[model samples]
Target: MFAPQSDRVALRFGDRSLTHASLAACAGSLARELTGLPRVAVWATPSLETCVAVVAALLAGVPAVPLNPKVGERELAHIVADSAPATVLAAPGVDLPAGLDSVPRRDVTLDGDDPGSFADPGDEAPALIVYTSGTTGSPKGVVLPRRALTSTLDAVAEAWQWTADDVLVHALPLFHVHGLILGVLGPLRRGGTLHHLGKFSTAGVVEALEGDGTMMFGVPTMYHRIAEEVGTTPALAAALGKARLLVSGSAALPVRDHERIATATGQRVVERYGMTETLMNTSVRADGDRRPGAVGVPLPGVEVRLVDDAGSVLDGAGPIGEIQVRGPNLFTEYLNRPDATAEAFAGGWFRTGDVGTRDADGYYRIVGRKATDIIKSGGYKIGAGEIENALLEHPGVREVAVTGEPDDDLGERIVAWVVAAGDAPPSSEELADHVARLLTPHKRPRVVRFVEALPRNDMGKVMKRALRT
Candidate 1:
C-alpha cells in the first residue's frame, strides 16, 4: 500500500523518522521473527517501536494484543491470561512490568533485510484483540478482523477526501483505536505521511503544520489546549488556518473550544463517533457542514439507527435512544465470551450502548453512555453531555462532569462535579442557573460539588464511577 511513497517520509517521532521503504523493511524483518506465533502482545508505548511491532505482527498475519504501558498489573495479568500470547514484543532494553514476566519476550529490534516471507492474510483472520475500558468489570478483549480495519479506514478516507498527497498529524497514544488504527495504519494504507508529536504540545503541532502537515487528528483535551493557545499564539493560529482538516474523536469536543478555535483560526474541528467494538460508524464529512457537537451522518456502507429501549427505531428528534449500527466495521466477537458476543447484537444491528439523538436532517448528536451519562430526574431522561456542555460555557468553570445522584423526591437528581477556573469558584447556584439558562430549568444541576479534577482514563475520558458524593 505504501509502495508509491517508498522514499517519502512515512512515520516521524521524537528525534527519529522513517521512510515508507524503511518502515516496510523494518516490519518485514520483525515479521520474520513473529511468524507462526499464536498471538503476540505489544508493549504499546507511543513510539516508533510500538508502530513497527504492530505492523510486523500484521505482516506476519498474527493477532496482536496492544498492551497499554500504564495499565495496572492486575489488568495486565488478566489480559495476559485471557489472550495467552506466546510472546510479548517490546522496545530494546525496556524493562517490562512483572505482570508480563510469565510470557516470553522478544525485542522489536528494527533491522534485518526484507525476507519476503509474509503474505497478505484473509479478511476473516483475526487482526487485533483490543481490550475495552469499561468501568463495570474486567476489560473484555474485542476481536477485530482485517475487514473491519479496511472498511472503516476506506470509509473515513472517502468522508474526509483523504489522499496520499495529504500529511496527517497527531499526538495520541498508540494503545487505542483512535491513535493506532487511524493515526498509524491509516497513513500507511493511504500511502500518506504521518507526523507524531510524541507528546501533545501546541508548539509541536504548530511546527508540524507550518511544515508539510495538511491534516490533524486530536482528542477533546488536545483541541481545548490548542484553543487556549491559538488566541495568543499567532503562529499557531496561522498554522491551523492553513490546515486542510482538523478532526477530533475518542470523546466529544466541547462546543466552547470548537467555537474558540474556529473564531481564531476559522477551522471547525470535525468530530466522529465510534467505539472499540465498532471501529467507526459515523463521521462529519469534510465537504458537509462542520457542525459543532454533531458527529454527522453514518459512513458509507454503515447503517445507524436510534432505537428506544423497546427495540423500535425512533423517528423524530428530542427522543434519546441507543445507537444501533449494522456494518462491516464491527468486531468479530469478544474473546472467549460467546454470551457477550450474542448480547451485543439485536437482530442484525449491534447495540452500541451509547445514547444519542438524530435530527430530521440525519445529523447525530451523542448524549452519553446509557449506563452512566443518561440521568433520569423528575421523570425525565436527560443527557449529561448537553448539561455539561452548557456548564463548560461558564467563565468560572474549567471542567465539569454531570451524574445522577439518588434523590428521595425526584427518584434521581442531577449532580455536577466541577473544577473551577482559577482560584475563585462560581457559586453552585450560579453554575446551576448557567446550565438552566442555557438549556432548560430542569436540566440545572440539583447539587454541585467543586473539585480539583475529575478522574480520567488514559484516553482523557472522565471516569464517573470514581467521582465521590
Candidate 2:
C-alpha cells in the first residue's frame, strides 16, 4: 500500500501530516532501532508520533502494547509489569508517568531512514497486546495476531466501500481497538488518508467534515454531542450531512440519537459490534438497512450465533441469547493466562458477555450485557438497552441509563437514572408513562433518579456497576 502512495498524505493530526513514503521511512528507522526487542509499549496519544510508533512496531514484528495516556496508576503498573516491554515508545517531549519513567525511552521522529519499505510481520505473528478495561479488577492483556488485525480491517473496508479515495476523519483515542486498529490502521490498510482531531470536539468535527473528510467514526458520547448541537447548529448539521459514511461503535448509540442525526443530516449512522477479544463480529453494512439500533449482520468471514444459558442454539422469531462468535478476527489469547483463555472459548465459539436478538433479516439487535444490562425483574428478562433507547426519546431527558435494583415484591425492579436536558426534567411518573407507552408497562422504570450525569467508561458505555454501588 505504501509503495504506490509514496507522495500521498497518509495521516494528519492537527497541523502535522505524514506522506506515505515519509511514514514508511520514519517507522522503518524506529523499527530498525527496536529490532531486537520482543515487545514495546507505545504511549498511545492521538498524534503523528504515536501513529509512526505503532507502524514501526508492526514493521519490526515486535508486538506493541498501547498504554492509555489517561491510564490510572494501578492499571499502568499492572500493564508495565505484565508486558515487561524492553522500552517505551513516545512522542518527543512527552513526559512519561512514574511507572514508565524508569523504562528506557525512544523518541519517535520523522528524521529516520530514507524512504523505503520493510517486510510486514507474518499474518500469524503477534501484532498487539491491548489490555482490557479493568471493570472487574485489573485488566488483562489480549494478544492479537497480524491475521486478526488484517482480516478485521479488510472486512470493514469491504463493508464500507473504503478505498484510497476515501479520507477518514475521527477524534477517538488511540489506546483501544476502535481508535487504534480500526481508526488508524484501517485507513493505512486501504491506502487512504486519516485526519485525527486530537481530541473530540464538535467544532473540530465540523472543521474536518467541512474540509476533505468523507467518512466519520465516533463513539456514542461523540454522537450524543453531535445530536445535541445538530438541532440548533445548521452548519454542524450540514457538515455531517456531507459525510459519505458515518459509523458509531465502542458503545451502543441510543436510538434517539440515531433518529436525531438521521432526521437532521439525512444519514443513518452505521453501527458495529465488537470487543477487545473479538476485533469485530457484526456491523450494519454501508449499503444495508440503517435501522436505528441494529448492529447489522455478521461481517464477512465471521460467524455469529445466539445460544441460551444451557448452550442450545437459538432459532425462530425472537429469542434473546448470549452472542457466541467464531472467526479469524478473534484474538489469539489473553497474555500469560491459559486458564482464562480456555474459559473464554467453548467448542470453537468465543463467548461474548453481550446478549442480543437476531431478526429474520439477519440484523442483530443488542439487548444488553449479560453481567449488568440484563434485568431479571418479576420473572421477566428485560434488556436495559431497549429501555434506555426508549427513555432517550423523552424531550427532557438528556442522558439515561437503565438498571435493575433489588426489590422485595419483584426479584428486581427497573431503575432509570437520567440527566435532565432542561431546567425542569419530566416528572418520574410522566417519564415512566412515556416509556410504558413506547415499550411496555412492565419495561417502564419502577424508580427514576435524576442525576447531574451518568457515569461512563472512556468509550461512553454507562457504568452500571457504579449506579448499583
Candidate 3:
C-alpha cells in the first residue's frame, strides 16, 4: 500500500522519522517472523515500533490485537486469555504489564532488509481484533476484516479529499480505531505523511500545522483546549487557519467550541461519526457545509437509517431514533461471542446503539448513545446531547454532562453535572433556566452538581456512566 511513495517520509514520532521505503523494509522483515501465527498481540504505545508491528502483522496475513498500555490487570488478563495470541510484540527495553506475561515477547527492530513482495491476502481475512471499551461487560474482541479497513479508508479519503500530498497530525493513542486505523493507517494507505505528537498540546499543534501539517484529527477535549486559548494565542489561530482541514471525532465537539475556534481562526472543525464495530459511517464533507453539531451525511457506499423502539425504520428528517447502518464498513463479528455478535445485528443492518436525527439536507446529528443519552422525561423523549450543547453556551459553564436519573413524576429526571468556569459559578436554578430557555422546559435539569472537572476517558469522552453513579 505504501510502495508508490517509497522515498517520501511516512511516519514521524517526535524527532524520529521513517520514509516509506524504510518502514516497508522494516515491516516486511518483521512480517517474515510473524507469518503463520494465529494472532499476535501488539503493545500499542504511541510510537513508531507499534506502527511497524501492526503493518507487519497485516502484511503477514495474521490478525493483530492491539493491547492498551494503560489497561487494568483484570481487563488485560481477559483480553490476553480471550485472544490467546501466539506472541506479543513491543519496542526494545520496554516493560510489559504482568497480565501479558503468559505470552512470549518479540522485540521489533527498525534495521532489517526487505523480504521482497508478498502475495495479496484475501479481503475476507481478519486484519485486527480490536477489543471494545467493555463498558457493558467484559470487552468483546471486534474482528475487523481487510475489506472493512480498505473500504472505510477509501470512503473517508473520498469524503475528506485526502491524498498523498496531505500531511496529517494527531496525538491520539495507538490502541483504538481513531488513532490506529484512521490516524495511522489512513495516511499510510494514502501514501501520506503522519506526524504523531508524543503528547497533545496547543503548542505542539501550532508547531505542526505551522509546518507542513495539512490536516489534524482530535477529540472534543483537545479541541476544547484549543478553543479556550486560540483566541488569546494568535499563533495557534494562525496555524489552524493555514490548515486544510481540522477534524474531530470519538465524541461530539461542543457547538460553543466550534463557533469560538471558527471565529478566531476562520476554520471550521469537521466532525465524523463511527465506532469500533463500524470503522466510519458519516463525516462532514470537505466540499460541503461545515455545520456545527452535525456529523454530516453518511459516507459514500454506506447507508444509515433511524429506527424506533418498535424496530420500525423512521423516515424523513425530524424524528430522533436509534441509528442503524449497512455497508462494507461493518465488522465481521465479536470473537468468542457468537450470541453477542448475533445480537448486534438486526435484519442485515448493524444496530449502532447510537441515537441521532437527520436534517432536511441529509446531515446526521448524533443525540448521544441510546443506552445513556436518551432521556424519557415528562412523557417526552429528549436527547441529552442537545441539552448539554445548550448548557455549554452559558458563560459560567466550563464543562457539562447530561444524564437521566430516576424520578417519580417524570420517570427519568434530567440532571446536569457541570464543571464551572469562574469564581462565581452559576446556580442550579440559573443553569436550569438557561437550558430551558435555549431548549425546552422538559429538557431542563431538575438537579445540578458542580465539580472542579468532569471525569473523562483517555479519548476525552465524558464518562457519563461514571457521572451517573
**Which digits, one per residue and each the tens of the lDDT, describe model 3 over residues 219-249?**
7768888988999999999999999999988
User: Scored by CA lDDT, what does every candidate get?
Assistant: 0.85, 0.85, 0.88
CA deviation > 4 Å runs, candidate 3: 1-5, 373-469
Best by TM-score: 3
Q: Which has the greatest lDDT?
A: 3
Report how far off residue 112 is in candidate 1 (Å): 2.2
Question: Residue 77 in model 2: shift from native, Å?
Answer: 0.7
Summarize candidate 1's per-residue lDDT along 72-178 as a digit string, tens digits: 55567778999999999999988898888899998887675683656778887899999874433456899999999999999999999998888999987787788
lDDT by residue for model 2 (74-105), tens: 55788898999999999999988888976899
lDDT of 2: 0.85
Clashing pairs in 1: none
Q: In candidate 1, how many Å is residue 180 off? A: 0.2
Candidate 1, superposed: residue stretches over 4 Å from native: 1-5, 115-117, 316-318, 373-469
Better of 1 and 3 by TM-score: 3
